[model samples]
Target: GRISEGSGEDPYLGSAIAKAMVKGYQGKDLKNEFTMMATVKHLALYGAVEAGRDYNSVDMSKVKMYNQYLPPYQAAVDAGVGSAMTSFNDIDGIPATGNKWLITDLLRKQWGFKGFVVSDYTSVNEMTAHGLGDLQAVSAQAINAGLDMDMVGEGFLTTLKKSVQEGKVTEEAITIACRRILTAKHQLGLFDDPYKYSDTSRPKKDILTAENRAAARKIATQSFVLLKNENNVLPLKKDAKIALVGPLANDKNNMLGTWAPTGDPQLSIPVLEGLKNVAPKAKITYAKGANITNDPELASRANVFGLRVDIDKRSPDAMIAEALRNSKDADVIVAVVGEASEFAGEAASRTEISIPQSQKKLINALAETGKPVVLVLFSGRPLTIAEEFNLPINILQVWNPGVEAGNAIADVLFGDYNPSGKLTASWPRNVGQIPIYHSMKNTGRPAPAHQFEKFKSNYLDSELSPLFPFGYGLSYTTFEYSAIAVDKKKIAQDEVINISFTVKNTGDHDGEEVVQLYLKDEVRSITPPKRQLKGFKKIFLKKGESQRVTIPLSANDLKFYNSELKFVAEPGKFIVFVGGNSNAEMS
Candidate 1:
């Protein structure tokens, strides 16, 4: 479920988001009143946990790490991120919190990162469980490895002095770590005023203003991805009778999703309320079609933080019966369904990445209503909806929209805004394809296209394709790509190649399209993924309007980390692919 928190299965996209996130947090100046410092965390392959389980060991080659997993952290460093946090998992048989090769050698020296390093919650202390040593030894190891602060563990506060006195850790190393931390504090203007951000009066004046909510509403709309829209069932009529039924339809508590403990749930607008606000004329009835999950144990786990998964007093049959009863008199059924907010954050990993069986039953029943059914799916991560995809219903992935959840959803459903959010990750067909991604290498016995070949890299029960590919999203308006032109077919290592392509909005409504660029290396010292994302531009096109979008392919875009661990671009013929998504045709 950590995929929900990242840029998803590609290093290039991850790098772009990393830089943008740093810029957004740090702003132009470190001492800016409106800006705060950013911390790039996990410092290693934390997401690629074994068996897709949290806190599990991660093992992969250095080549894979440099070419795939390490670029985003490096990008964050280049963007001037202020602090770095160590991962709980070990790298090369040493816990990341105590791994000098990762923190001191690679991150600080090689990547030129000047930021202070901190450990994840109790991570330095937890290294003892990793068989490194006792609390004193692990704390000494962490300080030696360039870790500055120990969050919540107090390992540094209790043991670092003793370790330094005993000569286990050098005094100079501890001093350097302390200096780095103090430097960060000074940069944040904390020395001048220790309570700079803690003024009680600021909360009422600066937080959740009308303008702030309006901005939140707009941003939330842009984050939604339209996964599937069969027959354009969306842009629902203003006066249509809508049976708004689902566990989340009127619930505000889960609107903010996981990892947002500070947000006020009461302030969030529910889907039922948002619809009324957006389309007063639309006759919308509401019902709790099903609980997030019928299983008591699952609901208990989700409720660890709060009552996010509220099991109803009514029976499942009674709930679905009421939903059916409500839909009988409605022209359309808009079912809001997905995992509870607690289903996808830290310590939240599932073997089956699908909608809960309880909600699935409600969805199937709603589809049988013979009315136009639209699913407003809410989840922090991509869900396996293979069975639901085959249904004759439109699907919109809302992704646990924040404080303005209802209003943002209402805007997209009523065509006030066309969803322009493209997925940063791929949606798998089933749990069997757990680690499925777009940039997978084709093995020696590559599977032939559009066919089933024995002894090939193919699945007998499923296609090797994701249910929805990376960069995939649909707009109410359709687009057509053409006129792909390049300034030159060939370029030197120092030269820039200009590629331009025309995109036309062919549908009746105006919408935004994310024009993506992918590159394929014909030859390299190491094997490359079939394609890698090079660049992308989001452009708005009015009905019947065409725009020629150009993005540069720089010399650095062609380079990759070789077996010798050097960044180099091998001479070869390269293929360029430009389209709406990653599964684009060659240009």
Candidate 2:
């Protein structure tokens, strides 16, 4: 399944999906000997990769770490996920695989996570590259950091015993880790039947059932974010002459996106198939305008490493001309473009995050046709699309939805469903201004207001901001936010604060709105971010109907790590903002 299958980019969404998937995989009776173990992955600061590159190092204040990245993982633990996977990147100058504060103090002690931690693929060995130490030293460090099992890396099996003998590691730690692994095995009923998940008959009968495919289609539709829908170009008419032009238009393999362990690309449905399923009578013309990627380096590596696709032999310019010729008289053009399956997964990080030149050329050619263009983007990480945002084309960000991706994309395009997905990571204007997020600490020398002097912290060439802020997404219908009322304008310490808002579906069509509630510390021992996402609610409403969404702010929600690195909520005034996205602030 696609990573999107687990959640729709919200921590609350992730928590809900985690509970459902855990319950679906492992029955309500977890004690049953035949239940499966679901593992929540890349525990901390893993989603906000610098420039959307996977496995990149993460640098953030301790307070930012606890406030933003830790919530979903903590929610996963609270959901009772059977296992937790450590991240590949470093947190606060220490590799997450070997960070004692991250693995033990924060995750285990503070969060009360009872599950064992598994190292990301060979992450224990990669610790040496992260400047931690040698293999033996990093292995010992990771074990001591509360990591239990080593996935595919023999770092633990190879050096742990010797480190124990040399007093670098304690025998008790080894016993605890080994016993945790044994306990997991026992929990999965592997002791009763070691090959429970290995049932060959189960794969044929249960892996991709009709009901599962239906669920996949529904989930995929919900995960799509309608980035641009100018003049209502979407909810496309079924009888129109549609030209589906691009390499991925009929690609079965590329539909599954990235990190789909059990997804069979060969059996996956393509966008063309999905369009046909929804608009069977529509006059559709298909053209493979360009490959998912045209870079030689990416093309060569993609085939050798990840989900390989047949490379186009002709030049990209020639292919674009052919596609342009095919779309000369079409009523509308649907351009399917973006990263390939391998371009966004682990070790597939890119320094530059824009559509390849070849695909851009194809889009430019299609744009000249004077036909309304609908652009569908399939990628795992967020892309910097400043140039394309204001184009004459409608855009949708579909993050590598799983097996029934084609069908889901078609469903949204033909008005069979509405898109509700929102971004989980920030989209920067350029790669240079990366490591940008909605929640960032205030430095001593902050950027001066309306000043570009040398002493101030302002950028000379570009704006020090993100192109698309977090918690940002557009629905087919518009919604209005008002009635920003708070229960208490002033509160004492340890008292709960309640914030309420009125959200109405003001447009013609029904839609879902994510009501975001942010809090800012007026005065504290240590300065907090400009604002922090304290609470959010995803609500669905019918056209012309209004709903009241209430968010509770607990004492813990306002707490932050002070100068001495202690979590505490200072007694002070806090600015409460209830709005749509990160930039939508109120007091």
Candidate 3:
């Protein structure tokens, strides 16, 4: 569930996205009226909690942390994020809220982060539960750790003054923390005018305008991933008779997604409304095929924030029967099915990452109708969809798209837009492959690409492959890669080399493609990953058009943290792979 909040499973991608987010949030200056300070939160491997559970202990070697988990935080710091929030979990046997090394040495000293540090909601007090200390001791420890602010709990507000009198925490440290907090407020112009950001006119002038919604609609279209398009069932004719069924098909509340607590759900468009708006000439029918989940306990947990998982009073069988009856006469069936918005967000973790059983039954019954089924899957995390993928149907992953959910769905359904988005995280075939990713290091007894070999690094029951690999996506149009070339096979450490390739639009649609490049070091001081994503470029092409794309490789791209924790590029034979996705074949 925590995966929903993070950029999917690769450090490089995570780093890039982190920098972009900081830039988007802070803009060119913090005092700018249109810009807001960005806070990089849950610092230090919160996403790597044990068994993907929230607030669980995290234990890892420095090497793993530096190479895999720490880059994004460093990138955010480099991008000048205004604040950092401590994670709930402990790091190296010390709670991150009170870990001096993490807050001062690594983040402030090593990374040169100028931002003030804040604790997660009540995290400073929660340290008592973590067996750290009582309110006063933990609060003192946190401030000594360089944390400038305490969120909720009020431990600092109530206990710090007494601690200072007792000499448990120095007056100077408290003064320093105060200075950092005041500096940030000054930077945001909060000191100049306390209500500067909350002007009454700001709502009407800046919030929820048509231009914002249009941009949201366009962005929503770009993010939809075409996971499967069996027998070219997608790009459906606008005039075709359609049956839209499932819990999320017409849910306005879930359209704004999980993180938007302040977003007005009523204003968000639903898929049913969107279909009519985009395809007014098409004959469309709608039915609630299934509840988000049939289990009352799960439904209750999912509805903690509100009525996200509304279980119908009707029996599961009755719900499926109604759906099948409605879809029977339609030319095609579009099933908007997956987790409710609350199923995968903060404090929400799932042992079973497949589609809910209730929705699975609805999908299975829809498949029996013999109409071409298109699964408009709504999920916050990559799901185990091997069963659905094998069925004769098309699948489009529309991950709980915000406000423009319905209009964006309609746009892609009628081929007004072709899906160019790719998966950043690998979709596991099953929960057993929880930690699968593209850059996994090669095992000593590596399994073959196909077929599982005994005594090899292969699963006994499942194939050694993800249900959907990282960087994998399908477009309505096909793209073919050829004529791969490198300007220089070898270059000095300071030199940059250009790798070029030809991409042709082999299918009959003008569409976009993200051309990705991966690199593998044949030999290095330490074990190297099978392949790591080095660079990418997004390009558009018309049918039968071909374009040459070039991406540069520099010394920084080749460097990695060795056993000594030094970043260095070892001299070796390196192989480069370029294609549509991470699973691209070597040239």
Candidate 4:
């Protein structure tokens, strides 16, 4: 759920990934007909949405913006992303769609970004709600602010012409907006032939091919994080009797996840269907143990695009009873649970991101049967799963595993594939701790003995640590990392330090391990994070096989935006950690 599963979420984000995405989307030449222009979005801080709500306002310092958030947008711009979409939130006093300082000054003049700026869906019209202006006034303001295109709202199309005629908007701003649009069209080779994407013959060879589905299944395994596999309850026996129970057990509509308007739900194989196909010998009993939610309104919201999650006619108590009844005679209880696709992405943000109470009831009932519980969780964001930890269960986080959701999940559960995926973000202990992250800043007075330290930054109810940290994931096989060895502790300003570590597969099976490298600047001009992830490696290892991974850390890696907003790396001792996850060890 933490990973950006097939959405506009991670199109342009982090440090170098944004640049890589631009190249991947646009290819070598933007003018090439085959290449598509990528729209790098939000302009700034969409991920840091307040309370994790969609289109919520964000307030952060300039230093934090430049160091933490601004680089990705800058990178996408520098990488030549064809279009930049404005964020829904206001920057300073003006909405992003009408912020001339953001679009004209910072983006165009300062960064030398040549691409046209576009508004997010109905963002221009929504500006009136932001207390900016009515549609006609806001549209003219947006054009004056350097926005070349309006997405889905006809605000600019309807108002810009009249604003120009009335002298409310300058002819030059309109001309520039028009010129940029035409330039983008020409660069995309769309001006030559606008209806190229309307071709009828492309689907037979390219879309939904055997090779594509195979790759989807493979990547699905890679994105999975085995949260808890207590007693090795997973790697489920192919010959055992398993009860597959829950709303998501055989739902096709939820497989492709959110923002996939063109996806065909009928083509997706549900978990039950995949298990049957994967383990033909396994005795599988299936039941719609519980609806996604007890509330009909929530179900209606979730099924906006299609009925991914539906409210059952039967009562919750009856459904839970049925699930328990089904699991009584089974070797193991496999509960398919968690968020439906609509619960995430765009306006799909949740106030409570946890396993639905209805599904949780079913899961708890099944677990009470004294049978091993294997939970397959589906989500698009980090959910508060602390309640589930009290029970004996094996948790696998499979975030919207695309069209091959069933086959991929079947493969993992039955040991056809070993999960090698690591979490990209940290999971909080509870929903109240929504803003938690791995690289959080250390306090002047840190937690005293990880307990209540009065007059400190410690929480009264929750702990300082997260339930699961960034880059955390388990394997069917185990991995061990030896001590870290650096080429030299002290180096010249331009020199690089070579860090090396040995990782060995100490378990029975051959599997992949994501070896992470983290560092903490002991003292800095500004108080840095407790630890920042500098580098990582995903390597394959056979049983008892060891591999040495060497990562080169340049002085540039230690640099940060100072209080003066100048990027510099201060000379100081740094604590380096390297191991399986973000909570790496040196001792």
Alpha-carbon RMSD of each model: 1.0, 3.5, 1.0, 2.3
**10 residues in a row with least lDDT, candidate 4:** 4-13
TM-scores of all candidate predictions against the true structure = 0.99, 0.88, 0.99, 0.95
Q: Specify the highest-lDDT model's number.
A: 3
Error at 577, model 2, angstroms: 2.5
Better of 1 and 2 by TM-score: 1
Ranking of all candidate structures by their lDDT, best first: 3, 1, 4, 2
Task: List lDDT for all candidates, in order.
Answer: 0.91, 0.79, 0.92, 0.84
lDDT of 1: 0.91
lDDT (tens digit, per residue) of candidate 1 on 107-213: 99999999899999999999999998899999998988888889999999998789878999898997898899999889989898878877889889888999999
The TM-score between candidate 2 and the true structure equals 0.88
Question: Model 4: per-residue lDDT, tens digit, 1-587?
Answer: 22353222221126567888889889998766567899888786666667766777877787877777787788888888889999998777688888898899989998899988999989999999998878999998888888889999999879878998999898898788889999988877787888876778888888889999999999898889999999998799899999999889989989998888788989998999999999999998888889888888888887888787778788888888877777778999899998889888777867777898888888778777888999999998888898897788999999899999999999999998999888777888987776777777877777775679789888899887788888889999999999679999897779999999899999998899988888889898888887887887789999999999998899888888899988898899898899887788772
Clashes of each: 0, 0, 0, 0
Q: What does candidate 3 score on TM? A: 0.99
> Which residue pairs show collisions in model 2?
none
Candidate 1 Cα outliers beyond 4 Å, as residue runs? none
| Error in Å for residue 2 of model 2 | 13
lDDT of 3 by residue, 1-587 (tens): 87888898999899999999999999998898889999997798998899999999999989888999999999999999999999999999999999999999999999999879999999999999999889999999999999999999899999999998999999999999999999999999998889888888889867779998899999999999999998899899999999999999989888877877887889889999999999999999899999999899998888776778888898989988888888888999999999889889898899999998889989988887788999999999999999999998899999988999999999999999989999999999999998899999998999998987888998888998998999999999999999999999897789999999999999989999999999999999888999999999999999999999999999889999999999898788999999888998845
Q: Give, for candidate 1, the lowest lDDT window spanning 10 residues.
A: 1-10
**Candidate 4 similarity to native, TM-score:** 0.95
Model 3, stretches more than 4 Å misplaced?
Answer: none
